[model samples]
Target: MIRHDTPSLMLLWSLLALSQAASAAPDTELTPIEVTASPIPSVAPLEGQDYSASRVDADGLAVFGGPAQANPYRALDLMPSVNLTGVDAYGLSVDQNAMRVRGIAASTYSNLAVTVNGTPSSVSAGRGGVGNLFDMENLESVTLWRGAQPADVGLGMGNLAGSLDLAIKGPTEEAGARLRTSVGGDGFHKLFGRIDTGTFNGGSSLFVSGSTSESDKWRGEGGQSRDTFNAGFAQTFGERGSLEIYAAHNRFHRDEYRPLTYAQSRDLDRYADLDYNADLTGVATTDADYYAYNSQHFDETNLLARFSWALTDDIQIRFSPYWLSNEGERRVGKTDKVMVIDIDQEQYGATAELVAELADQTLTLGYWTQRLSSMPPPMSQKVYAIDKQGGLVFSKWGILADMGDRAYESPYLQLSGERGRWRYGIGLRYLSFRIPGITSYDGSGLPNMSHDSALSMNPAVVAALSTDAVTLDEWLPTLSSRFELTPALDLKGAYGRSVGNPWMGPLYSVYMKNRKAFQKAGIPLQQLWDDLALETSDTIELGLEWRHGSLVLTPTLYYSDLSDKQVTAYDPAVGVSYLQSGVDAKAYGAELEASWGLDRHWTLIGSLSWNRNRLDDDIRAGSAAVLETSGNQVPDAPEWLAKLGAEFRYGNWNLTPIARYVGRRYGDALNQESVDDYATVDLNAVYRLGKVAGMQSLEIGMSVVNLFDADYISTIDVGQDDARPESIDYYPGAPRTLALSLSANF
Candidate 1:
């Protein structure tokens, strides 16, 4: 009999007490960690090569043993608490990216709230919402929190489900390098390399990794492909001191729909059956008949440093400085009717923290400050367009504007630790935002003609804010607790009044558009671009965790009450959408995750998360705020998401299979029409042969995706057709895919 007694569970009673100590640092994602598993693996490389290289080696991971599919998000979406916004297994979209979590995405561009070795990724295209989160070449281990979370998250607004944390591989042990290549269907090809050296004394050697990938689109007129480059290096100064550096550059190009219709999607998909999808795309994209086209070029760079020193056994100090920069430009064909952006963000902070273990309790304290600033684009050009048949006419309207410059400072504190059977945490935070004139535009470049998208042609679109308040300021408080119930079980709970200032992304502000654009006259002019606002919410979560040998289970329940819930809506007249109206809403959910470590030869893991959110009221028409979600489930939020998988290893052979499930959702919030539910099963296998007499280490693997060849819609959204007839829109999934790769280590 297992007695759920306090004394019997004391050792397993790990408590996290909250603190307001200036010594605090940002909390990371909750990646279900199996301490019993082998420590993160690392290896060395050939001499004269860039050492300090390590790989999570997604290639060899049993999950990807099969071929690549449309779901580029892949294992990233299967991790605990992880969810996707625009991802559906084998969906219509080839990119199959664009994501959100909890209930919202980090920004419109789908930038995830990511921390690479404790450094936040830059989301500003040019001082605001503009890019993606990762380059497979630079990724180490991305730990996903998947939903309800701790405070100190979200550079701006966030989702209701979960979060993800990415740890770019750094110097671990030995010194080594690697080079690999692979080619697959649809013109898919990948090449990459890496090297790393273990930590040196209090300091470690450096490491670097980079890769490039390109693939042809399987549908539409013009296909698409992309290239990315990444590099990372890190080392420590003393036992408590360290330095990490990283940088990335990406260039992307894609053809427009070439007038492809929603109905024709299935026709293009049919090409997959004949093994000629990519070929069809390549043929349709010739210069003679090419009509519409879009291509975007983006560049990003980042740098960070963290240093800590132990003044005493119970006290320590830490400091960090980070800088990021990004710039992007987009154009349709040869027209200068382009969108340009440039952003540079930086942060510097210092902290003093104490961890004192007393006879009866442990105490913690800390404090810190930070500052952020943004700058709009530089000199720009407005071009006019004239088509032979006037089919798709474009012209520069006039007066380009820029979102004004602004910056802010924040101070924070916290206290947490364990005292006997009780562990508690409490903290406070405050921020200030300053913007003299949030919207600034030049009244130049007006073409002498009329166009529907005039305002959009201005190239420089700024958020509309008419506030005399030089600074937006706010304060917040939080609390948390945990208790050990039995040696094999523990209970934890947390509540906090957390507030987020809008980011330069999905979060919007109300604005007016030009008549003849997408709106009617007399519409309010509340330009909705990303803005700064205070979002306060109370969150509570309870968890029951258990561990037996290598078997582990964690069941969690949570609720969130949001005040001024920032929702995004679109406008027509101004040709814009903004984060304007917010209402009261509550989100509650439960998640169960378990992994049974049967034996070295057999093990199983599975997880499921469910959430329900209710809006307090409905949104009005054309404020560009169309939730259309009256009395229906929230868009992009599914009710139930689950996954299960099992793996068995024998001698040098391994076999595994996985199943994924996604519940149905309404095409619109009103729930008038519903999308059917879907599920997928995949298979994988790997055989590791001992090194050849003259060879070091070598491996080969095979993977199959969407083994069943099922057709399913992963996402559906509110859309309107000609005459503005309200309708739902959906993105199709990719067809089944297969991949095989061979690798060696020397």
Candidate 2:
């Protein structure tokens, strides 16, 4: 349950502790501390790193228009080789947004890993990261590492592309409080507040924050609301060590929206709701609205504990342990035969690192281990039937499906060292997964046989039964190096191999639903199992970085080869869907980013990326027809992306203007349907009032998005083979919108 008084209680407890510590300590003069840099640094490339990485600090984040509901990931859209869709004026709704790295598809984020304070945030069931759980108002920095990840970071299972890391802000040296409130278009309103407790005599500090936001749907009938709370405490144990603990809780609810077809968008109203259909029996005709009943609810909580100690003068050790839990439910479709999904998951992990100072080199060794268990039960219920008067009649309840227990154990080791101007690293990981049980209802609304009867009935059933735990393992390795030839120039290269495990949902569905059905239709179970394999990839890249007095430039070229790419196929003969490990695929790309200080008060930033991806061979379709997809562009993979922005600051005011462009893209593997290129512009301004009235700080900001009201497709449902205009699968982009916000700190 969401508690509005939780933040207040936490703040009260922190103050009480602070008072006691102060009363018990001696009266000693406080030492003065020197500050060298701003609390948040500007966006910059990582020096002495072999791979491509970019860091955006708090100041850098402000350049992205300072939306009321800030989303750190949205700021990465300006970076090279990154694509984002469905972003609104506030840059919120991370779950609704789709993010793509390089030429990879956005349906699943298994290729990318996301972390907060070294804790893994991605769901164990391949549903991307827990982005909605984070309180963006408390973030200090967000870093994006493209391509290969560092050896010491091993908190994810399937990280073939790279990782995104977010760090939270630390407590201030002096006690302070901040509050921000905003109202904008679409009935949008938000309230955010934070409190910081300065260090006490015992060298301890704490901070607590909370936020609540709600907004009406921009182009639909429904809306969304969210509540979040975050807290952190740190204690110092003299110069030997320190301990820090952080926790966050989030509750989110939203109504799902139905996508529109091209014909509906062009002929009917762009925001029309056509999600109503007649009953199957044709006995009573009433409004069976899909959108009216479609909704989702999520609750997530996370806790992390970090401990550091200097074992000796030459050695230091750090240990971090984290725990996370999530509970969610999604309801969709008609009221009569509504589909409901309940997911419950719990995960815990720890990472230990040791740094040793050696002659001419610094050696680092680390180990990471984590365990996850999840239970997802899906059911379809005939709650009620629609009547002629748009009323409902009651019906019976029955179970549809259930997955008993899913678990994973991941462990990895990392070793790296730096000597002089050359640096190198290596890493290895082993991943294991298991699923224990499953249950599904039959056509007559009766429960199927249990594990004993089902296994005895058919020998093949024994191998496919979910009750029999199955385990799969894989080993991953990576190597990278960097060379600094001059003070202003550096060369880097890396080779990495990564793996993507098959998702448990698809695996359970295929084994429980398709295996028996296919066997009844004369297909062997062994053939089905053999067709599924783990997805693997090998990537190689070379990069160059050149820095001048007031300008920084980086260009990188990379190539990747993928094998055993998992794809879904339908068997016409058996009327069942199954997974197939298709042939090899390849992708090559180039990315360039440049930042220049036009003058003392102005800065220019630009980025450009080009990439191509294609399959290496042809495959047979459901109708037993050979489709020549070799050398054809991958579905939904755009060819070009560009971004440019300029920032100007004078006195207490700053203004920013930004533009983005995306080239044409194919919607199908056969390149039959396509969407045209589009561009957008945005402008933002902020004014700061220092020590206004009795307040320590005050600021106001406004942003305008889609300045020209461009009409284009923001995203598309790929795999469409037809060329009919009505069959075009696309999601229309948002129109022009404006937002304003005000904040005060005391």
Candidate 3:
């Protein structure tokens, strides 16, 4: 258990004991101190292919700032063709953060495949997503792919946009312990510690880490808190095979910041400090806006294991299996009451990969499969009444259901070779999806009761209803080539196809609301579901790389043809809106990145990108009416983005400053509700203290985020391009904040 009341005092006592012990010990050789320049992000091809990939190592993450070091999504803010935004300095608000790669946005249902240590992760996009699972201190590097990915890399339900791979640091061979603590603006405080057990007995090593953090909202009345624990063990079997196991648990709770309208965001001077109501009124309707009523909670646990063996000198096999358990609830204040949304999910999967060396070429074959089960279908809602004493009273069930079993399968193969100055590769992947049917309970007229109790009271078949299942499959292929023009220059190109899962959440909601209407019309709802197809994209890209003594430059261009995109359609027979997959889209973009080492003490990196994602034709709103969306850009997609950063080191001090700009964007499909462009700057400084209290190393860091305090709309919550103005939401960016941290290695 964590001691929340006196964390600082406990750490101080521990350090004092270490200091007294060191003073009495005999003289000994101290570890050497290294003050090297910070590492810059590397934007290069992947495995001799032309895919635009970027990698940020441990040092690179440090240069991005302490917040970036803690948040994986924030670490990609300065990378080319990526955008990330949040409301808190520490990125603890999981439900409010937003991320976009290229022109694709990631929301509750994102189309980006995210993985950790080569295993599928973040299967559910809501409630803090991937950031809540592991601390950045446990990560060695983060790699991102912008365009079409290789056959073996993208392994999940959605891969149409991109993929993010996180590599965790393994147990070290030497025994050691590290401790870190930080205090920042808005009553923020955090403590983290890790211990590594050196190889013992035979060839086994173990590691354990834990952290506790809490912070007050920058502009609101409430705060956020989180606790995490991680453990791992590894063993080597005489160099022929290895086994590893890892486990993690996290619990997060936060009071969300309220969003504003387009007009409200424009008047920053008057509305910058506006937040959720802190005091409740006697009137139930007025008290519905209370800050305590609008809060969220997330609790999750995960376990993963890997085994590898070498069959021969030319062949090797590896298998990884993972399991995840997640439960969360979000409470929102309504006009007269509070609504609670709950999710309980369990996911289990495995991946087996084999590699063989044949002649001058390398071949890889892999298969991946996963099963997801939801006891109460994700996002199920319940209503509650507020008592005069400000307590919650159970009202009624808003949505209740048990989702059927969902399964996925994929088998992929890839081969690559290098001949002379030309290198090439070809790959193919087959994907299959089985969407779960749902069994919904009739709770409209019933009180808040357990599932078993409700069923027993009803004692009739009319209490529950079930739907038919749907199955879909697709084939994806990839081809890539590279030609060396000179020792310092190279040309590369690639072509691939990718797919995205359909909008199932909205579809299920529509069906539940209109089940009787569908039955009356002699439509089983499966008729509409059977017509739904997965979104697919075929992309082609070309690029060139130029490298010199102290500078590296790369430029890339890509175009994509998208089919069966998810869109909303109005059905007059049911007099309701339903999700349909028939829209087509086209996207094209260009990106350029440059890195230069000005001198041994300084390094600079800059990037610029221009993207255009537009509709190919008009959208059908009804059987006879059409929405004029042709030639219009997608909502929330910026046309231009630019970033610049520089790092300088002198003796034991290192300073880094970065600037970013986001171009204008529209809020609706009709090209109305335009948002203005904005720019912001940030600075971070670190000073090495060598050794203290017998510790091998010590460092102090200071960071100032949003240095200029520029006010702008950071994220817009609009799922549909043809959304109404009242439904669109605008979230303001975080204000200027400061943080200080201390780290020690013993």
Cα error of candidate 1 at position 692, Å: 4.3
- Top candidate on TM-score is 3
Off by over 4 Å in 2: 1-41, 106-109, 122-131, 262-288, 334-336, 375-410, 435-467, 507-516, 521-532, 570-577, 717-729
Model 1, clash count?
A: 87
Q: For model 2, what is the error of residue 189's alpha carbon versus the real structure, in angstroms, after optimal superposition?
A: 1.3
Give TM per candidate. Answer: 0.73, 0.85, 0.93
Q: For model 3, how does the per-residue alpha-carbon lDDT over 1-746 read when each residue is reduced to its tens digit?
A: 11133223443445445545654545444344453544443333333556777777778666562552456777777777777778777787765777766677754244778787888876754543333577778887788777777888878768877878878887889987777778889887877777788898789999887777888888868988777777789999987899988888877778888888878877988887888888877677877788888887778888988899999888999999999888777788988799887766778899999999988888999999999765323436788998886667888887766666678899999888888998888899999988777666667677676554555666333222466788989998998888999999989888889888786667766777787876777666567768869889899999989988768888989998989988787777776667877888998999887888777677888888998888887766767777788888888888899998887777678788989999998777767778889999999888876655466777888888889988988887776555544568778888898989888777
lDDT of each: 0.46, 0.65, 0.76
Taking all chains together, the TM-score of candidate 2 against the true structure is 0.85
Local accuracy of candidate 1 as per-residue lDDT tens digits, 1-746: 00111221121121101111211434322222123452221111111111111122443232432233212245454444344533222221223244444444333112244444544444343223234334443445444443333334332323233334445555557765544445555555544455555555645566654444445554443334444445556666556555566665544443322322224323535432222112212332232233332434445455656556666665666555556555544333343222222233333333334445545444544443344444332223244343443333435432243334445455555556566766766666565655434443433555543222434566344433222324667665666676778888767666655454444323211232333342344332333332345555677777766777767677778777866655544545445544554656666778776667677566776778787765666654465445455445665467788877777666666677778887765555556555567787777776665543222334566666667876765544432100112344455555556656554433
Report residue 441 deviation for candidate 2 (angstroms): 6.5
lDDT, candidate 2, 1-746, per-residue tens: 11122333444344444434433534433222332322212666755567778877776676562465556767777888887777345555555566667776433235666677777764534332254566666888788777666655535656665677888787776887777767878777777777888998778999888777767666656666677788889888999998888888877666654566755544335444343342234233234444444566677889988899999988899898988887766555553444445555677888777887776556667666666665332333334455555454544333344344445555565556777887777777666655345545342322243323333443222333334345556666777887788999888888777665554455455655566677678765444444445567788889888888678789999998988776555567776545566668888899998888766667777889998778887755557565567887776678899998887766677778889999887766767666678999988888877665445666798877788988776766542221222444566666787778887666
Count of clashing residue pairs in every prediction: 87, 0, 1
Cα lDDT, model 1, residue 37: 51
Q: What is candidate 3's local distance difference test score?
A: 0.76
